[model samples]
Target: MQEFISYKNIQIAFTAEGKGKTIVLLHGFLESSSIWKHLTLELKKTHRVVTIDLLGHGNTEKLGYIHSMETMAEVVHAVLFHLKIKKFSLIGHSMGGYVALAFAEKFPQQLEKLILLNSSPVADSEERKQNRDRAKRLVKQNKKAFISMAIKNLFTDENRNALRPKINTLVEEATQIPEENIIAAIEGLKNRKDRTKVLQQYKGEKVIISGKNDPVVPFQEIKEIAEQAHSNFIAFEDGHMSYLENREELGEKLITLFS
Candidate 1:
């Protein structure tokens, strides 16, 4: 069911369904909880599924001009706390993964598992930070152009034409996001700290799922992260948007991991 919780005087939107060991899904930057619709339909059958629109995304309101990963994690905690959910397996995609790591650091006892999909625990490298600055400027100048290029770049060249409709849909949804929110998110991601230690110290079930051809987070780095963090690794044969490019495989893998 759809619900909202007041966080810092703003409504934080979320959806919860089914009834079992709770599982919380967090989407990447430029994405909201709605991105998990396809997986939620299946995962809810055996697990209580909850997807929250992180601060500045989906139905949630922006907290401020700088929506840090730590703040986003707090918002997730508020939603679950309001719902009386004590423990849950957390799955985060892209930017969501950064939030998950922050959550793990603050609420280790409450998390049963940490799964990073198409995301890395490493902080923004110098080049990436520069890229983010450029992106923010571009967003302020031509939001539509930035959104179009950003979404398209998520997929490989081979899948671009095949997934044009889906890509367009993503672009459409992202375009609705205000320029400030986009800039806020970019700032958060660019400043996010390296949480490799948190992942390595996490004693619960941990997994890192990545696409072999992911341009955002390199496949080799993720594989090494899995090893360093002692996380079970699952690799898909595609680019970043594995949920769309490797739907069936990802769904099955998630079920097995969450179970």
Candidate 2:
């Protein structure tokens, strides 16, 4: 069942389903809790799956002008706290991973497993920061165009045509996000901290799942980071949106890890 809680005077949306140990799934930028419909359907069969629509996305209300990753993490922490959930595994995709890292840093003792999907621990590069600035401007000027261009670039060229239908659906959903919310997320991502040491220092079970052809997070860079952190590395032969391109493989990998 869907539920809401007040945080910073806003209603934060989330859902808890099934029964057993808990696993919380966080979605990427321009995505809501709805993005995990497929994964939740499968994971809920074995584990109590919880998915939260982070601030400024999905059914949740935006907190403010600049929603930093740290601030977003606090929102997640508050929601889980209200649910009386102490320790649980966390899986974050893309921007969600950035929030996960921030959460892990503040509440290291509260996590059982930390999985970063198509996410990195490093801060935004100089070029990336500049791109974010451009994106923010584009969002302000033409939200629909920005959403369309952004979603298409997430998939690989080889699979773009085949995945056009899925891409269209995503674009439609992303287009609903408020202009300010989109910019808030871009601001957060651009200013997120470098949590490489945080991941490396984490003592609990941790893994990095990446796409070999991920245009967002470079595959080789993530693999090397995983190695340096002594964390397990799982690779898919697809792009950033592996949940759509390699759905079965992702489900199996998640099941095996959380089993």
Note the Cα lDDT for every prediction shown.
0.93, 0.93
For candidate 1, write residues 1-259 as lDDT tens digits. 6799898899999999999999999999999888899999999999999999998888899988899999999999999999899999999999999999999999999999899999988999999999999999999899999999998999999999998898989999999999999999999999999999999999999989999999999999889889988899999989999989999999999887766
Question: After TM-score superposition, what is the CA distance of residue 213 in candidate 2 from its true location, in Å?
Answer: 0.5
Per-residue lDDT, model 2, residue 241, is 89
TM-score of each model, in listed order: 0.99, 0.98
- State the weakest 10-residue window (summed lDDT) of model 1: 250-259
Once fitted onto the true fold, the runs of candidate 1 whose alpha carbons sit more than 4 angstroms away are none
lDDT of 2 by residue, 30-131 (tens): 999988999999999999999999999999998888889999999999988998999999999999999999999999999999999999999999999999
CA deviation > 4 Å runs, candidate 2: none
Q: List RMSD in Å for every model shown.
A: 0.8, 0.8
